[model samples]
Target chain A: MTELFDQVRERVRRNVPVVIATVVGLDGSPPPSFARLGATLVVAGDGPSAGSLGDDALDRVVEADARRALLSGSSGLRRYAVHGAGDGRPAAAAEPESGGLTEASGPTLAVFIHAIEPPPRMIVLGAADVSAALVRVAKVLGFRVTVCDARPAFATRTRFPDADDVVVDWPHRHLAAIADELEPCDAVCVLTHDAKFDVPALVAALATRAGYVGALGSRRTHADRVARLRAEGVAETDIARVMAPIGIDLGGRTPAETALSICAEIVANFSGTPVASLRDGSGPIHRPTRA
Target chain B: MQDILDDIDRWRDEGERVALVRVVAVEGSGPAGPGAAMAVSEHGEVSGSLTGGCVEGAVVAAALEVLASGLPRLCTFGYSDEDAFAVGLTCGGVISVFVEPVG
Candidate 1:
């Protein structure tokens, strides 16, 4: 029912992880399948399940699998062997974690478990020109963007209208408060080119599981920042994770262009793609200027 | 589903029964990955997409069927050399879609 989908949308709006297990396939080889193709079970983390796979027993089995999919934060297909047994479906009765490819005995219920996770976070640690630009791009890329700066004057909602959150707290403290929530999918961009703001921000950003940690500055500034980080006793590996002189070498000078370069680096880094410069690659880079 | 929420909400506001069609599996070279979904109203109005403008017609047909029969169905769309005029993906990739009636 739409109420089930509403529950899913509500949970997603609250940034709570949920899973939708829909019966995508049903094999009636053994006759009388408990699930119909298109039957659905909406499973929320630690919440009551909405809808059903046409059987209480099968719903329990799918609920468990949905919880696991929520934990893994991936959407894919899963399968459970249907049996006219007890009031509940047995997890061990099937592969339990099969990828819907198992040729189990009797009929089978193939459910596509889709995980609805909160959008990945992008915490911009500065509310300057570049920070505002970065928030715009990050939002377009489906990140929950937060722009944090200590100065209330700079970090106004009017300044970064696209940012989801505008915080006037010290950058490092703001990062520390939300550090536990940050995962490898999140990113922290230190657009504060100042040593006072950026140095401590980098220290906190590196400690978190945030996948992309970058500081904006020129080469000379990056070298100085690195030496300062070393002096602060930060580990070499942690220091190395900092993408100072942030962004790929697109050679663009505008704030928007810089933001693109930085976000490009973030995307490339998180996707595990080599951040190789285009100049390093040999071959035609363009489509011959439209002939 | 999130991508098509606005339309789903509008259709729901207008008292329309919607069939939710989701891509459960993609064999190879699918333009959209698994979880790609489309919401279809009982009247065949559609929102969102599953493939690169290829299999939507078939999915809408299936969604309408699910709404009419009140039973969900699994529809597979892929390139079939023998069936010319068949509704399938132009790209050789196969996708398994689940079409269900949603309140």
Candidate 2:
């Protein structure tokens, strides 16, 4: 069990996807000796599985469930009948069992399936002053941050040493090339002050499933960009997904404060939490006291 | 569990027995959900946490007991539980933790 746990730790450290399936409960006359309670199995993304849950049939069933859980990015307890007609067969479906301690009819075994996914990516465009701070803040928040810019001089690794990746390329082209890799957990932030860069970059971002698509700009600049987006035939709903004049109404100044707001907004977006953002409020973005 | 790996490895290098505690199920408004884990070394060192620091001391005691008895058991801490006492979580939710010695 310790060896299995060590494998799980290694995979998590390397940001590799893994699933840990542990036999948490057993109810019956008696369980197999090898099927001792708390027997755990660690399954990696593309390698051999470590440990087992005693019986081969039980291990097979749990392994399949672990893979599904890993893909869905969820953890939960699942119960199976120990002596059903088709005992040890693939579970047809995992119904939400009520009461953590409620035992099902016949002998039952409960396995807790926990999936560990790689940290999501935060692709920040422009590599400008704000981008540098945003990259740092996002890294602190456990995101695999990538700083991208069209200018070679500004996008170097030295400028954003904390970022996981520094790519010097046109914003839209870079986003499009890696669009398929973006998951709903990922984010895209357009920090370029220039419309030429922010527009196409946002267009590409909105086309993907990236959960948070934010652009840094003033209200007038966002209005102009909206007109350009409408002219380019981007749908109204898709355009609405863009968080223009991004960041929460933290009334903060400086690049670090703005970066905090943006990262906080991304977290709020994913968590389905409503926050008071500057984009939604009419008052001054920063308080006079701070200035 | 991932957060406490370094400390666990250090303890293991020194050949100390350790108990791993995992939150298997959380009931209603619990602070931490399933898969939240913590480890307690034989030397009484603890790493990670199951809740917002309400029941960790009791959990460490449970871990030491498990290490001494060499037994795996399930312990629950919450407001609605019959055993709710000084060590229950203040969050008004129930969390069932499985404590077992690492082999």
Tens-place lDDT per residue, model 2, A199-242, is 89888999899988998888888989999889888999989898
TM-score for each predicted model, relative to the true structure: 0.86, 0.84
- Candidate 2 error regions (>4 Å): A31-34, A45-48, A84-99, A151-153, A156-161, B1-19, B40-46, B66-71, B80-83, B101-103
lDDT of 1 by residue, B6-80 (tens): 788788889999998888888878788878879999889999888978889878888999889888777777774
Measured with C-alpha atoms, the lDDT of residue B54 in candidate 2 is: 83
Model 2 chain A: ten consecutive residues of lowest lDDT: A90-99
Give model 1's TM-score versus the native structure: 0.86
lDDT of each: 0.80, 0.82
Error of 1 at A256 (Å): 2.4
Task: Provide the lDDT at A151 for model 2.
Answer: 92
Question: In candidate 2, residue A11 scores what lDDT?
Answer: 88
What 10-residue stretch in candidate 1 chain A is worst by lDDT? A278-287
Backbone clash total, candidate 1: 3
Say which candidate scores most in lDDT: 2
Give per-residue lDDT, candidate 2, residue A49: 83
Q: Which of the numbered candidates is closest to the native, going by highest TM-score?
A: 1
